[model samples]
Target: MASFLSAFSMFGMSSLGYRTGFGALFVLSVNLVPLGALWYYMHRKTFVLGRARSWMSMGMPFGERYGNGMRAVIPVVVLLASIPYLVAQVQGIGLMVEALSEKAIPYHMGMFFVPVFISLYLIMGGMKGAAWVNTVQGIFFSIMVFILFFAVMAKNGGFAPTMQMVFDTHPELFQLGAKGGKLWSYPMVFGFAAAMCLGCICFPQPYMHAYSSRTVKGFKTMLLSFGGICLVIITMPTLVGIAATVIVPGLKGVQADKVYGIVASMALPDWLAALAVAGGFTAAMSTVNGLVFGNATNLANDLLKLMVPHVGQKGLVSAARWSVAVIMAICVVIAWNPNTPVAELSVLAFGTVAVTIFPLWGAYFWKRSTAAGAMASTIVGFGINIVMFIWGGKNMVLFPSAKLFQLNGFLAAFIAAGLVFFIVCLVTKPGKIEQKSLALFFHPALDGKLDHNLVDRSENEYVKV
Candidate 1:
């Protein structure tokens, strides 16, 4: 849960819920299927060796088959993905604090100086420290939000009554694809659903978390537990957003981002509400810290290390620290004057990282997967995403007759990348696979059984061309 769920998720879910109540659940339930399926495959890829194999080591698999191409491109995409999320977190803090303080604390005040704290902890303590902070924050936020949900439920005369009231007054909020709804309309749903699904599937942090499992059984347990926890965490805020519709009503535009804090203040006691506020801050902080460190490692291990392959561990550490400062500074500056809503920012992050999906998965499944195709897919996907983000904002493509049938940047970019990936793979010649190139991913034990030991297996691995 701590791996990816953050203020980005909480604020985004609430805003979605506020706009369209049960529509938020509809989106999550639809998107989470792909996210969970991909996560499972990614888990098998990393843990097949019976050890954690992502993070600093994840590049090894791609590096072996795809060589320096993947090492060069993946880091940039990962960096791009992290920025939107970092901006979302800072935006979350600013929105929540401003709402909680009743605007005595300005929005910028909440955003300002956050990067400083992230830089300090990440530069000094690294990802371990970030993970610890995320764990602690995730636990606290999870508990408080669960308690806060029922509190709001009781105060609002229970879930069914709230729904009855809303239906009586504003039925559009719960309609999944109502035409006149501000955000829950079909066009909007298509875009956000793509964003949420890709975002959930492609974020780098969860892949790293997959590496922590020491055993297959333990890994399954972790995934199952994570799935359940995600349902709870996601449900609480979504319902809170629904409850906000009744309690506060009439919030328009980006104002819906503050629904979480407003509802907490209305439902909980003064002391608990304050704790809830603190929980919100911690949620934002945890995600920021994690992204900061994640970006730092991406710079040091994947990008920088390739350029200077001989750098020792000490030099890498220094480079990662420097990367933290630089990256955090950039994110803070952008967050300071964000033009995008927190929900949109989070969606953009998902679309950015998702560019790598074809480049990554093709290596394991497709025999014709080539480095050129991988690199081209990365560039094409990223380029299309940038184009659509800037030029395709609220612009729909295809099925010109009906607005509801159009596709958004997130889905369009992903599809374009995959198409290019397949074309490039067919046109280009693939490198040798029957060697030590994929010993780790294609262990000999994988033939009919499982083995934890490192097997010198490559000649017969993934060779069906």
Candidate 2:
């Protein structure tokens, strides 16, 4: 999941540091809250709800526990959310490839190359294949960060001098409102971080990845490993971004996203710059594969199987492979003419899907969480998110005439989803169907004692209540 921080995402991270200074690190660090949430909620959810058939079954924990409505809704949302992110990864690959080859390869060609090459192996290897690739990619990106960190520090006359430069020249970036005006206020930072945490926890791909783990120990292993890896990998981009501000100042608009690439190309020797491109490639490619594979799996297992139950396991794999090819083709076209900034694109994806947070987590802990509530939260919350996105001027504002800082679309949608969930659940009692489904995730001590009441609480009883 750390690889989900694509090269474009790293670019955004660094850009955040370049513009906002130390404040950006706070946004990156809040990722752990979701990791902790995953450990507590998803780990058990996967075992209890996901273990019935193949761990990789279509509806997964959501469908198994919630009902057919959720089983249907989650796959479509997961597939849609994966698109922009896939484009971002492809765009990142295109940027670095073009830079490394000095424009010989060109952006369009590089974009095509990454998806085609990765998909070839990805189709054959599946999730387990992605696991092996991610391992190597993770190590390579880690080494890349250390090398860039030390090199940037050395070029700026060591750590103390670098800190002195930022303090003396750009100290205003640290202030909540900055010196002259507000760029990144405390509230905005909190919202962005919280949105990111929620998105990561509820994002479909990561849920599928969690389900792939064979044991509780493996799940815990992933939780710990992701936490430590994020701490190291996420911080690297910030340091590099801070260094870029000092060394290569005055980058504007889309140019700022290329800060790390520019700095590496200029500051390092030719050989190291070539290696840096490879590092970026590794980062972006790994993420692209995971996103593509996860979405493809959803399309095949969740959607197709429901349509054609006679499809065999081999047929499903073939369906997944074809889905990857088709999705990558769509992403290539989108990457060719992306107008949004890499960071905003990422944050936008998070904000849009963050509506899932309440519905997803509530299933595990909230006993009264009926399928009606889950469906309401998913549909209404997502509807509100889209409304806010348009009302906020795409990616520009929280709502009409409001700026980016105050109560953005993500927070608005998240709050709306929670309110709807609670209100709907309270007003409408759970039907016998929902009560039976809920029993799987109930506390073990409640077993046997409530079976009678659960069996007796039919739709008729619910209507009377």
Instruction: Pick the TM-score winner.
Output: 1
Q: Which consecutive 10 residues in model 2 have the weakest lDDT in total? A: 450-459
User: lDDT (CA) for every model shown?
Assistant: 0.70, 0.70
Tens-digit lDDT track of model 1 for 119-181: 888777776788787888889888877787888888868877876877777777667564553
Residue pairs whose backbone atoms clash in candidate 2: none
lDDT score at residue 282, model 1, on the 0-100 scale: 75
lDDT of 2 at 59: 55
Return the TM-score for each candidate structure. Answer: 0.89, 0.89
Tell me the deviation in Å of residue 191 in model 1: 4.3
